[model samples]
Target: MSEFDKKDVPEERIGLIDLMRTIKVVPLVTLHSPEEAVPLARALASGGVPIAEVTFRSAAALDGMRAIHDQVPEVTLVAGTVHTVDQARQAVEAGCKGVVSPAFSDAVVDWCMGSRIPVLPGTATPSDIEKAYDLGLRFTKFFPAEAYGGVKTLKALSGPFAEMSFLPTGGVGFGNAREYIDLPNVFAVGGSFPVPSKAQRQGDWKAVADACAQARQLVQG
Candidate 1:
């Protein structure tokens, strides 16, 4: 049995979904080294955005999460690019408050469902959305948003899945972030654009902070 029973979990609490919506922008990050995690988190918070989805695309994910969780408790953290229950469990143990997958994985979703852990599975098509709906999930991540038609596609999805909400990632940037946030169906936007590769690699935390501040302004405005 899981640590938290599904039936015992209350619905009134301000959960991950609520936090994501409130933040309006979630930085999708992949840390190259654990040493960068605390500074990177500080940059995000200083820039006005205090949430990050640390991806498992790199081996530094767990350590990076630990660094931020231990040093920057103010920044909300979630695990991204998770592929299995083990990864999800590790992420939770490492201090991530939620889990996000690039693709819907049955095992991972099931584990989250049973454990009452919040998860935003990726849904790129009608079928994928239906699967998520059937699993009782109302919020999901629309991935590779640009390639799948971006705003146009999300507009269409709203017609049928009216109650469904999304955090559209991939190809999202400062150039068109306002367009996505304007949509009622979109709860928030996720991408690495706010943390530019050049800035992160060069340890130019101010640049990252500036980018985050700009993104927050786009969402609020």
Candidate 2:
């Protein structure tokens, strides 16, 4: 009955946990410098996919993630390729909305539970999916999507994992992103195609923005 803080409420719904679904596409970017973070994030935000899954594959990842969170406050940032508990801790500290791993990690999921952070544990097999379900997590990341049989595998899993939802990434590009993203079982899609590696390296914010705009049009059109 008393007043409660919104921060105290940890979102649980797949639809809510992964706000990327509303936008349809979530860019996975890894900028090398914090200075690039603001512009890159702004580009994506302004372009329409105002959401990004910034991964921890670089030394600048944490600070870059924080820079985006601070500068482009409207852009929802999620941490991706999280492989360690230390990385998970640092990610939340940097203001990431959720944690995504390339592979299932009980430790990472456990850390999220203890810290009250939304964690989209990755899955590739039935056992992996069931592990997430057993952890009371209905949402997950389907990594290496293309290499793992992509849509065919997702369809087959949908029979038993009917209630589950996925955020398929890895190999999800502009060409085939629509196929996986349009699925009823998929809440959203994540990939670096929207923010190309060369573009990021060259500080080409406009290119990133244009890609985001095109991705938005594809999802809407």
Candidate 3:
């Protein structure tokens, strides 16, 4: 049973989940310069994967998000590694369609729920999953997936969390991405694998695009 009396889960969030399921892969992007935003987003789109999870690990996250929002409107943007309500608010203002936290922060979750913003709180254990479930959240992120048993853990979770879906991130890469995506409980896989670090740092947009295309094929193939 849910702990909350009324789950104010927004209707639009369902559409977002459906979109993610179709995409099958989400690029976990961290920007060092806002200038890289437009080109990187365009590369992802050109490669047939038009979604990016711009993490707030860098100082330039907000500016980069704003640039992508304004210049590459076709790409779906979600804020990642968010730690505070302030960051979440800024992310939405910068044009992120949703908020993704690395851990389940009650304040952040409550705020996003009240504001009608879609939030995917990270979960690593049954307790964490229960917290999200009690709040009426059906979708959550399984972080550090490789470190936490990878496909095995997801399989174990499926029995107890039959109605829940997951976005498995952390340590997910091209080699085992399809394995994760094949799980019935997984909606999509998230990682920095699609945007290779060397390619991104060297401003090799074509390499980045090629990496994305390969990743897309790996899952959809």
Among the numbered candidates, top lDDT falls to 3
Candidate 2 lDDT for residue 52: 85
Residue clash pairs of candidate 2: none
Residue by residue across 14-59, what tens digits does model 1's lDDT show?
A: 3676777787999999999999999999999999889999999999
The local distance difference test score of each candidate is: 0.90, 0.83, 0.92
Candidate 3 segments whose C-alpha is farther than 4 A from its true place: 1-9
Candidate scoring better on lDDT of 2 and 3: 3
Tell me the TM-score of model 2. Answer: 0.91
Candidate 1 regions exceeding 4 Å error are 1-14
Cα lDDT of model 3 by residue, 1-221, tens digit: 13331245466676677778899999999997999999999999999899999999999999999999999999999999999999999999999999999999999999998998889999999999999998899999998799889999999999998878899999999889999999989989999999999999999999999999999999997
List, residue by residue over 109-220, the lDDT tens digit for candidate 2.
Answer: 8988788788888898899999988877777899888888898899888899987888888889889888887787887888888888888888888898998999888766
State TM-scores per candidate: 0.94, 0.91, 0.96
Strongest candidate by TM-score: 3
C-alpha RMSD (angstroms) for model 1: 4.3
